[model samples]
Target: MTNERSLSQKWADFRATKAQLFWTGIGCAVATMVVGFTWGGWTTGGSAQLAAAQAGTTARQELAAAICVDRFNAGGDATAQLATLREMSTWERGKFIAGGGWVAMPEMMGKTDVAATSCAAQLVATPAPQAASTAAP
Candidate 1:
């Protein structure tokens, strides 16, 4: 009677919902493909942007090494200078170079390591000045 009628009405509502669900699932699949090919695709602009960012990072590191070299020549134990430079923030390193060193950045990025090593190589270990002369009276 009324119970049977309500059960039929509920089944009808479920039927309409099933059709809507099928269409929604298809739409979601199509959208997934579109996005996969848009940004994740090989031909997309993302790779070029990544390469540009990497190149910029490399340039900055080389500049930092050159500045480290300049600061090195200004004076200090080479080993100590290199350690100090590496510890500095990128902004602080830039300030350090701008504050004093005039050495030029090398054309190639790999040259920075060598420049730091060379600066350290030139350091001559000398003994401190003795306050008293060691000559016999």
Candidate 2:
């Protein structure tokens, strides 16, 4: 009889501990979820768009550099072409490069210079097209 009594007492003790353990586990789970949501960047938006914009900007920069190189290789006045490139805005630079690089002498740039100095400068810098140019000799 005493052994049976002891077994029942142990069972009661385990029940109490189990209740506490269950509640503790619930609390831990809730806490972990709250921390994860708060600290994690799961709520952000438009990351893809931001990345695309960055990539586009980089591509435009590379194109602009190619345009500058073309101008320098033309055997024109490097100093003047460089000055015009520095003075142009990003939009202007893009346009100029897209338009086969700045023309050697535009009528004006923003009404400041008589000819579009930036556009014309590149033309002056590049080498003259030679005759007898062909794919093969």
Candidate 3:
């Protein structure tokens, strides 16, 4: 009877050990899944932010290019038109335009008559210095 009782105790201990191991494995699996989900969320968020930033940049560049083109069409001197184009550099125009080119945004793809007329007016108006100089001469 003593030997039989000892064997039963051993069996109970072995069963307890197995249960503990099973729970431990489940915990590890849960941890791995959480980590994977967190990583995926972070990557997706970063990509979305990057895309938005690129879109903004492109819009600004398109606006600037439209202005510059309008100025050129209005009979403004080449120098002023060039100056306007150069001013666009502060907004990183090249990168902005390039981004738009890649994404093909609707705003970048279409043109309006209003913008053309405004640019023409802006470009044709004599720059203040040029007007003064011409008056002086």
Candidate 4:
């Protein structure tokens, strides 16, 4: 017989090496996936969707809070209302804001609870202007 080896014979001769290469490739793939997910900030589709939903909710709440603040400040008795709101306990502030109809925007119908709470926080954080009093020097 001639001293030449056919493709099938060569393949058969390297069967052990072939298996080793295959296993090595599999291990490398698994390692890359593990590293990428653990430290590369790679997010799955489900996690990305959840994050997007949460961001949307936060944006909506902030927008509604802004509108609520504007409406509240535009009222004729804003100073008096602000004083009253500041006197109430923290837990009652949201209810007071909601009752004032400041969080009644079209986009805030069912989501008024969170918006009202945010509005109350913004209102509380802002200092109301003091009334000027006349006094004799």
Candidate 3 lDDT tens digits, 6-125 = 777887776457889999999999988788778745356888899899888656655755655543445445565445544664334334323323223356445333333334444434
lDDT of each: 0.55, 0.53, 0.52, 0.92
Residue pairs of candidate 3 with colliding backbone atoms:
70-119
RMSD (Cα, Å) of model 2: 11.3
| Model 3 weakest lDDT span, ten residues long | 96-105
- TM per candidate: 0.30, 0.31, 0.28, 0.82
Q: Give candidate 1's TM-score.
A: 0.30
7-87 in candidate 4: lDDT tens per residue? 999988874678899999999999999999999899999999999999999999999899999999999999999999999
TM-score-wise, the better of 3 and 4 is 4
Give the clashing pairs for model 4. Answer: none
Sort by lDDT, best first: what order?
4, 1, 2, 3
Better of 1 and 4 by lDDT: 4
Compose the digit string of candidate 2's lDDT tens values, residues 23-86. Answer: 9999999988788668854443587678887787555544444454565556466555455656
Clashes per candidate, residues 3 or more apart or on different chains: 0, 11, 1, 0
The runs of at least 3 residues in candidate 1 whose Cα sits more than 4 Å from the true structure, single-residue gaps closed, are 3-22, 30-48, 51-59, 66-103, 108-137
